[model samples]
Target: MTETRHPMTGNEMSPESAGGMERHAYDVVVVGAGGAGLRAAIAAHDAGARVAVVCKSLLGKAHTVMAEGGIAAAMGNRWPEDNWEVHFRDTMRGGKMLNHWRMAQLHAQQAPERVMELEDWGALFDRTDDGLISQRDFGGHRYARLAHVGDRTGLEMIRTLQQRTVQLGIDVFMELTVTDLFQDDGRISGAFGYWRETGRFVLFEAPAVILATGGIGKSFKVTSNSWEYTGDGHALALRAGASLINMEFVQFHPTGMVWPPSVKGLLVTESVRGDGGVLKNSEGTRFMFDYIPDFFRAETADTEEEADRWYDDKKNNRRPPELLPRDEVARAINSEIKAGRGTPHGGIYLDIASRRTPEFIRKRLPSMYHQFKELADVDITAEPMEIGPTCHYVMGGVEVDPDTQESAVTGLYAVGECSGGMHGSNRLGGNSLGDLLVFGKLAGEAATAYATGLGRARPAVAEDDLRAASHSAVAPFEVEGGDNPYAIQSDLQQSMNDLVGIIRTAGELERSLVEIEALKERARSMAVEGHRQYNPGWHLALDLRNMLLVSESIARAALAREESRGGHTRDDFPQTDHEVWGRKNLVVSLDAAGTGVELSERPLPEMPDELKKYFDEPRKES
Candidate 1:
């Protein structure tokens, strides 16, 4: 016997038509209007489902706009020999063999289609002599493979997707923040949140929800992440009965702006390096050659002459050491600064002017030139930019089924930076935007099929749960006087920065866990002065809870791993324990009471001989 969908007041109805607190009825509610969310909503809509897109900021101001490097795809536009197999090999190697084999395969196979689709939908990319999409060199790729638009690739991508979303008539609820997910009887029902500008409560009754809320980088004091990245999606998934995997893997991008204290964490696009920028220490040495790791030694050049030759004839020459994956490069820069070879601002120098012509630098990296010139008083066309590491992205997120992108919770899906199991322990450069398109489409299609299959059956929202959620949201404002939310937030960021930064120690991680507990208490006692309407204080107060919880998750997972792997480096245990930690992944989920997170170790899913044979080939030169 088949159970039919329960009849409800929220079927194909507008907010005004729906009764009592029900804002709208959507078959799918896609949170975050960034690359992943927009792509998901578009896919769901194309699948004949009504979709609603909830964005915390304005439509165009999503953090995806900050992505400057090109999107990675083996289109073979530049290097005719490049293909999906080579791309897969590069991805697997870049992740240090910790990536889920199936996801990497799928991403490589499907990426070309997605990039071409973007072009079909009015995305104007840089072009080649033959008029095909132009691809360029990036870290961890075997060939010139990132399709871009100078340094504004992200801007063009977002514009194209946004235009497509509007063209399809997808309902976009801008300036909204989804703080809590509503579930009933072991299934997800809908979500509850508030408008950022008006602060009025909003409810969406949907059978399926996709979380694409980016990363947790803002937890650190120095980060390239924006204010919205406070781990909302990661925490919401944990509390909603979905486990998180690889929570310890946080990528510190190697070349963020390090001068002008006001702009210390701003990202310096990898495009500069892709266009022939070189890194040098204050001693006027090209120090990258001295820092190449053994993993990449076979592929990297041993001399400056060979490296420079590779720039013109890559097929015959080796790759420069500066093109190593982010993890190696970031650690190298950190080493240089610690060894007292750093600039006055504690960063090494990236010199493009000395290597490339002024016209070429300005033409290829307009944003980089202007950013350094305007922000740090450095003319990038004539001088070098001081650069260092900064918290960039988290490779760990909600654990989802590789094929469907569905979480453990029924009716819940995740993709992009908030979902795990794509890049593994470390992400390769230019892979993030590619990940967004490939998995975002899958999550959306899967959620729509799951919802449409329900045939109108909806999960009932329990009154007790709704009341508790409402109270928790309003508690801070009702307290009148208590701990200031901003202060607690600042303290949390500082603790995470000092105790659990790029290079960690056992004692520091233990201390971070302790400080996280104290910050949790501070979060509970948080007080907001203004009304909910346009109240940044109240918003921070709410976001503080998510950040505190996610920070503790990262620290605890880092401690449990007991070995350095990818982005997680421990001074006490500096070696990579491939036999132990490499075979296992740390999973984090809520306890039965939904009050705390619990950790467990699980072996990764296996790859069969047929698929595993891909690795049998000699590793490509990256």
Candidate 2:
């Protein structure tokens, strides 16, 4: 596909033109307004930093609001035996022990406090009879550790944080998409972006910048992610010379809708199973019971009575088969479908309709009921929902120090889903929301402390560099005729879904690389027809650059890691080769050519004896 090139003189604003153009400077500039961004802004403001939160969407409408599973925190409500130590162990095991121990430890230790902080900030989580936050059972969690708000946990969390930040008077730049990071003298100086409403470029000069811009799921076809999840933060950080770790481990959620072609990939929240839904084949057999791995065999129930009993008394029995970790369940469903036991739609039936009362289903899963009715024309409360795997989360992202949340670049930082080495291979359901809150606060504190020590040193930003970035951002729109940006995006997604998807092999990955290169070439010639106001076409055009860059990094990292570990499973090399591939994390950087990212090895984090104790205990009930 070819795009028409329109040669128009530049009306784009330079940084100098932005001088009198409402140029707002803050002590910290946050590039996303999701849960992490809001929390980070609040923390920075509390630490005496003038903070601003920038987002691509309207306030309270971040992709974080779409998360349905609850936040994981060991609050000891459902399981008195649950604690941070147990939480840490489950996280590590769920990630296949590839998780950064220190990061996991910090996340586990700090999660409960973060949950309470949200409550104090006015989040109305479900309450137990005794008045503490109520907890729910989620896949891979030994205890009912997830604190939620009726399957709308993300909405409650984001709404509460947004409200709290607004009351605190934090400056917010809604509907602004960051285009480039401005750096000078080996430190971050500021950033440049476009205002979607006015179609004007804006500059933010700040010594500290926080990237809480979520994941890169939009890079794939059939993802349960919003259009905003385009690897912008990961791309921006990488372009600023920051190293990314574990970009290969992308998580595919097992239960996305799979009937209608258009909305087939939308996420069917895990809350369905948490409320006693079952995954069944065409013959009505619960298939997960026969596919338990040794790692999870002790915790899972093979029988219906045991699974039911376990929900009430987790100490004596095992978890329901439907509650297996996402990776295991996804693989099992794939196998069943391949064996001709799948439903007519090629997906297994996720049925809660027959088992639970309609009132209870409606109360526990209102959004699921609404989404299915509106999008798929199926009443989830009355029928089994057809479900399959869809690209959901990126487990690997920009590598940062576990405690500091600081990347290799001194002034650069990453938090939430954009940062890596936290979830290892497969993230347990409900862990991500807690991960965002805990690390978002840490990133803010660390950045504030660092900024405090170095007071008001303005790094030099070049006008030419900023102008070049601005022009680059607007270049696709300048093309009068060419390949459609949407078409290019569609092609990219299809390519990723076909070759770089759940099960990958060497030949398939290589083919994916070739397809990516072709798509990148076509993207350069892509055209945008509409004006910039709420223009999804324009937004997608800009996001394509980040998607292609991050996709290359992911593919490169996957090729380098020879063993099957975590989310990266190489069919050619099926076994986990811990002796060699296990020791070091793959870190990627730009090569001498300044084009493709170079992969280097960094040592796996050392877990102290105290921290390692959590892993030594057998998960079997005493």
Candidate 3:
């Protein structure tokens, strides 16, 4: 194969490109440099395959770094009874049993080993008294199962993975956003993207592509996600003929800063509650006990006394109502606010000050301490935090094979928050981190095998496709006197937040679809000012397409699933229909005309008797 080296930039040029654009060739290309992307790259390299990791932001700055709750793994360090089977059960039940059984099974069985691997690679987690890795309690698990470093577990995990990636000489393309995926026939051939800083086009010619881009929380008006979570990977996969599953189930985290306009939607980690904080209403009443759902009643404590005691004696007492799954807690908080019992800022209070000592709070929750002190000027050790629900995680993404993390489209893989079905309807706290590591490794190795299996017969990206992608990427700059991308984005966010948020109705979902259609029309005429060189306006314009497509998917899927379950709560349906909705998973793909979204249903994969017995057996309290 002959390649030309560009004059100014040291990038290779593909012979098919008449316009000598920057190009790279690798066995596997991994998009999004978060935990899953980094882990995938490492795994691919270990399998003796050339790998490239592409990121939308600077290295080590993906949303994975914002994960403060910890990595969930049944290490059994805190409670000797904890194991993968218990974890598997907790995960399935927490997700409202909508999870892909095999994915959940694989995650539960491999998470502990992944955590140990991270530790072996230089992650310094908090230690137990016996010199073992200490574990902390999170929402759904029976035992203390999260391995963490205070409130900075994600930071440590990213640091370790980033270091390992660098040490192994895996190539990483930072600040490059993939706009489209190239497919030769029905198989992935390459990826097309541009550098964020310079706006120069770049292409990765590879037989396999792994999408690890995180969630789509930014589509909402109030979200804990950063600017980069615009559903890029989800849209790319859908446009490439890969179906998305469970798009309706979007997690609204119960605790996000609701005071001070500037930091309203910032995340307040679940670690606060796991470490002994409690939720209270404006009347200073511990209100979580009153809102416990019937589904979790048997395992959850009914009274504050038992709930408080369970923190110390997990073997004898039930878990606290405050530690219920996120969907339950978020809905409960919303109920309090709607019932006129909320604080002045339209949120309830999360108080750790009254429950734990100041020293302990600072040590276990240093980030929360500083985040509150610096952002809100409310010392978390002395005063309660005013927080409300914020759009957090998306439990929906590209449909992929549970064993390999490969999508329906050949040679295309997805993992992390971009891949669906691991968390069913709602995700348990701390599972995100573990999901990243476990599936990332699986996808990386599988993509490598697929790439290497082709031997000398690799697919090539076409010149006409490259030209079309380039024209599309630069179209916003050509429009004059058109709609502002920022204004359209803001309107889209408002529409989603009001019509398709934590609670939804058929009427609202229908209205949202209508609004989204109008927004798509406006997005077509979106114009950006100035050249693409480091222009934020142009970037936002490009990202709007992805956000709109994903938002529509969520609205359409939510409208079809006329039942309340986990993250996809329908106020109209009001109850979970375990018979119909529970048995089928909603899928979203481009219509036959390749214009609008088409929604369909597929039966949930049956779990074999051997694995199904875990759920049927008696609940193990210990």
Expressed as tens digits, the lDDT of each residue in 126-159 for candidate 2 is 8888988889888998888899999899999989
Decide which is better by lDDT, 1 or 3.
3
Residue 395 lDDT (model 2)? 93
lDDT of 1 by residue, 118-192 (tens): 999999998998999999898878788999999988888899999999999888888888989999777888898
Deviating ranges (above 4 Å) for candidate 3: 1-19
Per-candidate RMSD, Å: 3.8, 5.3, 1.8
TM-score for all models, in order of appearance: 0.96, 0.94, 0.98
Q: In angstroms, give how far residue 288 of model 3 lies from its true place.
A: 0.9
Instruction: Give the 10-residue window scoring lowest on summed lDDT in candidate 1.
Output: 1-10
Question: Judged by lDDT against the true structure, how good is candidate 2?
Answer: 0.85
Query: Per model, how many backbone clashes are there?
Result: 1, 7, 0
Alpha-carbon deviation at 465 in model 1, angstroms: 2.5
In candidate 3, what are the lDDT values of residues 103-193, reduced to their tens digit?
9999999999999999999999999999999898888877889999999999999999999998987887888899989989889999999
Q: Rank the candidate models, highest lDDT first.
A: 3, 1, 2
Full candidate order by TM-score, most accurate first? 3, 1, 2
Candidate 1 global TM-score: 0.96
